[model samples]
Target: MIGTALRGIFTLPDLRKRVLITFALLAVSRIGFWITVPGVNYDVIEEIAGRQAGTWIDFIGIVTGGRLTNASIFSLGVMPYISASIIFTMLVKLVPSLERLQKEGPQGYRKIQQYERYATVLICIIQSSFIVAWMTSVTAGNERLVPNATFSFRLMAIVSMTAGTVFLMWLGEQITEFGIGNGISLLIMNGIVARMPGKFSMFISNIARAVRQGVNPAKEVTELAIFVLLFVGIVAFVVLITQGQRRIPVQQQKQTRGRRVYGGMRYYLPLRVNQGGVMPIIFAQAILMLPIAIISSIPGLQSIRFWFNYGTFWYIFAYVLLILFFEYFWTALVFNPIEMANQLQEHGNFIPGIRPGRRTAEMLEYILNRVALAGGTFVAFIAIVPQIVSSLMGYDIFLATILGGTGILIVVGVALEFVQRVEAQLLAREYEGFMRKPMRGR
Candidate 1:
């Protein structure tokens, strides 16, 4: 496998360059994770964060690739950009003007993208300001997170963080254009994955400590084995679901004109089982975290914090329900059977055993609805189970995240997408490229 990958990497000059560029850019991003924001004490922030582990802060830190906890310049990460894009996306669906612009083809698409960029900057300013304010207010047993709480210091911090986020967004775009994969997704995945080595080390150290304390090493080893097995299984499951699709058969009518005949063929339109991909989970996480962020900020909500506390039964229950809801909601937005059927009918195609119009549309919707229900449930279970297990085991939240169902799904989904792109490039160049058979007779 390693040799094959290396050969593939070196096969094309452009691919090799793209892969190199992606790694270099990611390295720069990781460096930014350690560069702290001015005026903040790392120890105090760490202490506060540790005490508040498993809260919204922890989730944000994971998403930012550990930047938020470090109080770095890139603390905001690509979240502001994601939030901005989502806002614009929702607006485009709801507002007629934006919808029209969206349908206007390339020029219109560029205009919307420009609007998204503007909105991203605006969101960056707002989110950065709030982050700065929140950081300034953090205290660890009377030690201020930011020692010098001055207007100039706050302004600098905000500007630095916002600029860092904007730069990261630019880096992601560059990676998409000139690198190997989906840049933004890779950035977020990098953040989630960057902590893996430390997590493994922690687990090893914990086992050593347990053995030193006369605990049964056998039990611990067994638990570790189970954890590894579960992680692999979940990754495999996610990969399967991410790649799974339902192919609807379509038969085209034959056309004959004089000496020419056309359009007699059968093909299938593939509708993925998990059409919404990770968006449903992302949306659900953001929504669930919002309340935690708000309550963390407002002291008056302290009394009710117990109910909303991370790892609590209520929290997990709510999280699962929300994920399920968003899965269906997002699926609806992205898939419309009626429109699909109309287009197919207009092209003189029909699904076998189903009427060409409304009936086919209904059948498609029925199949989609059933598949979506099962997929949504599976995703929700995958997301919640790891959190529940980690909380019970008292292990590192970071480890839980990687071992957690959602993280594995994202990693598998993104990795598969990257591989598919590589395969497509290879296939395109093949014969003339790789996977070609020799001609039998010239």
Candidate 2:
């Protein structure tokens, strides 16, 4: 495998250079993740973060690849930028002017990206203000998160965070231009992967402690092993599903003019089973986290805290429902069967046995809906199973998270995308792609 990968990499000079550039950029980004923003006490932030485990803070930190917990300048990570992009995406779909811009091809898309950049800065300012305010309020028996919450401090925090987000966004764009997979996704995945070594160490430590105390650690070790096995299994399953597609056969009609036949051929349009990818889960998590975050932030809601705590039945129930809802919603936003059908019809292509227009659209929609149902169910299951396991096994939610679900999904998805890009490069250079059969020498 290593030989094949090396052969593939060396086959294309441009691809190899791009991959190297991506890693270099990623290393710089990771370094930025450790550089704390000015005016914040790192020790206090770390203590607060440790205390606030399992809350929305953990979720944010995980996404930022632990930068938020570190109170780094890049604490906000690319989330603000992502949030801005999502907002504009919705706006483009709703507002006629923006929608027209979207229809205008590459130039217009660049314009929209510029708009997103502006929006990202604005969002960073707003989010940073709230973060500073929240930190000011956090007091553990008179030890406040922000020791001296002055106007200058607030200004500094906001400016630093906004600048950090902008830099991170720029880094991501650079990675896309000069690296392998999408930069933003790679950044998030890197953060999540960074936590794995610590989790594995903890698992080993727990087994050691149990054994030293003269307790039979077999059950715990067995459970951890099973969890690991399940984690790998789910990752494999996700890769399969993420890559799975329905290949709709397309037979082109013959167009004969005088002496020559121009267009008689067959091909396929591969529609992925999970066309929406992890966007649905990301959207759902953001939406679901909102209410819990709000409720947790309000002091008056302390009486009903049990109802909103993470890993609780109510929380898991609501989380799963939101995941399902967003799966359908995102699918609707991105997948347009009618437009596809029309394009196919205009080109004189039709699925075998299916009519050219609306009927073909309906058939495609039907298949998509069925495939989406399976995919959605699997995603929801993956999202909720870790919580269930954590609760049952008496392990930390963090440990359970590392074992299966969202973190694993992001890891697998990003890795697969990276591999696919590499394979494409290799194939373009007339080298065998990763999964192709090796040629035998005569």
TM-score of 2: 0.91
Task: Compose the digit string of candidate 2's lDDT tens values, residues 78-175.
Answer: 88887888898788877999989989999899999999999898999999898878777877665666778899988998898889889989989999
Tell me the whole-model lDDT of each prediction, alpha carbons only: 0.78, 0.80
Kindly list the per-residue Cα lDDT of model 1 for residues 16-88, writing each as its tens digit: 8988899899888889888998888877866875676666677776654546767899888888888877788
Q: Estimate each model's TM-score.
A: 0.90, 0.91
Candidate 1 global TM-score: 0.90
Which pairs clash inside model 2? 65-191
